[model samples]
Target: MRLHPDIPPGPLHEKWDNCRFSNTLVNPANRRKYEIIVVGTGLAGASAAASLAELGYNVKSFCIQDSPRRAHSIAAQGGINAAKNYQNDSDSVFRLFYDTIKGGDFRSREANVYRLAQISNAIIDHCAAQGVPFAREYGGTLANRSFGGAQVSRTFYARGQTGQQLLLGAYSSLMRQVAAGKVTIYSRREMMDVVVVDGQARGIIVRNLLTGELERYSANAVVLATGGYGNAFYLSTNAMASNVTAAWRAHKRGAGFANPCFVQIHPTCIPVHGDYQSKLTLMSESLRNDGRVWVPKKTNDL
Candidate 1:
């Protein structure tokens, strides 16, 4: 990979600030001409669509769910990770950046990871402003917890239903845009194919999941946020309807599918009783608090 001379080199902490001032901005007056089609109603897609609409873009959002709130994002048990360091646990953005890079086995781009850390704090503030009802302290600030491979207590949560609360926050903001008629919400519509009129994505072919009717939604740019391909494992934690079709089709057309073989299995899944089990219940990882696992060295010990 060749580095561009124009790009700034700095400690990860300063990279975003350097890039922000250096990046060119699209004029607000010209933003109205861009029509963006965002697929999926997860936090990323819904928030992007709503924010784009807020920025004066002609936005069209799609979700197979009858309501945006039903997207698989609502099923997240754990909380979203940020580098708030509210617990005085000696957390910092660089530690998070280092941990994430090490956790991903050094495969993730440093710049991208740094950018996520940069935006981590803002995401908390953004969610808070939307009245997300995050769990708070007696002083009425916010709560924090530890999660996964992190050494600090920077995870912001709303009970065990953090994803549900965050998704509701984004959904509420999306609905506000929909009510203003700035964004056109296409519910119960599953994108079947991306309509690439030229070398770039111009639109998409979507199926009305209810009536089986196919419709074409043309836009200046199409964004797909349909989520992971965990379904490839045959039996995983992903939603039953979730598939890689849209992203795979896009890959066939162009975009390279990165890290095609990453899997993370927690130890708390219920013991599979039989082959007929459709899904596994994810007991919160927090259960590691009380439960303990042990195995006898000798088979006869059982």
Candidate 2:
């Protein structure tokens, strides 16, 4: 594809603002007509559902967790990345985008990475407003830390429970919507498949995990934030029940699965103690900066 000269090319900072204003919008009155279904309670799913409902859409959110709070995102021990540059160090959008692209071994789409970089700032602000109790500096400003290959202190975290804190923020917002009746949250439900009518997603087929009864749900559009299929390895950092069923069913229904083999293995998880060891506990990569990484020279040493 040839580049369009009229498009902005200076930096992502300039491109997002230019493109956002150029996009169309649905009037507030018409926004109520669109019903959205989100089938996951992880950070992505819950946050997306809450934000969508706040925008006046008739939303229905589902999760297999006994509560939305139990989504796999809650298992995330590390923090989220944002480029606030509060440390006045060498942090910036391009660097974060480049790090993510290089970290993923260049398999990720540049457009998606760029957009993630743009919205990352808002994620931090949104979380702060929800009173997540993030670790803060003496001056009461939010604290930052380094993670992985990033050089700057840009990763905002809580005391060894960043994922839990952030998920709570998103969940709080979701609960507010549930209380208002703007969003109908169905807990302990598993999404079986998406229903498409005449080439567009119309609803979904779900199963009540507790009663084992199947139900049909109809909506204008459905969103599958059910998360990744890292569990396909049978032994991974993923939750015990996490599977590719939701995304796989969607793929079979026409949502293309891209880069299915892209898996990033963190190097510092606890070594398997015995053959019966069930799962590995990740000593967050954040610990690597302060702790030294080592391995035995002999094959039998471990």
Judged by lDDT, which candidate is best?
Answer: 2
Model 1, span 196-261: residue lDDT tens: 875789998999999999999899999898877777785777788667787888877776676678
- Write down the TM-score for model 1: 0.90
Q: Relative to the true structure, how large is the alpha-carbon lDDT of every model?
A: 0.83, 0.85
Best candidate, TM-score:
2
**Model 1, residue 266: C-alpha shift (Å):** 3.5
Collision count for each candidate, in order: 0, 0
Cα RMSD, model 2 = 3.5
The 10 consecutive residues of candidate 2 with the worst lDDT sum are: 1-10
lDDT of 2 at 4: 36
Q: Could you give the C-alpha RMSD of every candidate to the true structure, in order shown?
A: 3.1, 3.5
Model 1 clash pairs?
Answer: none
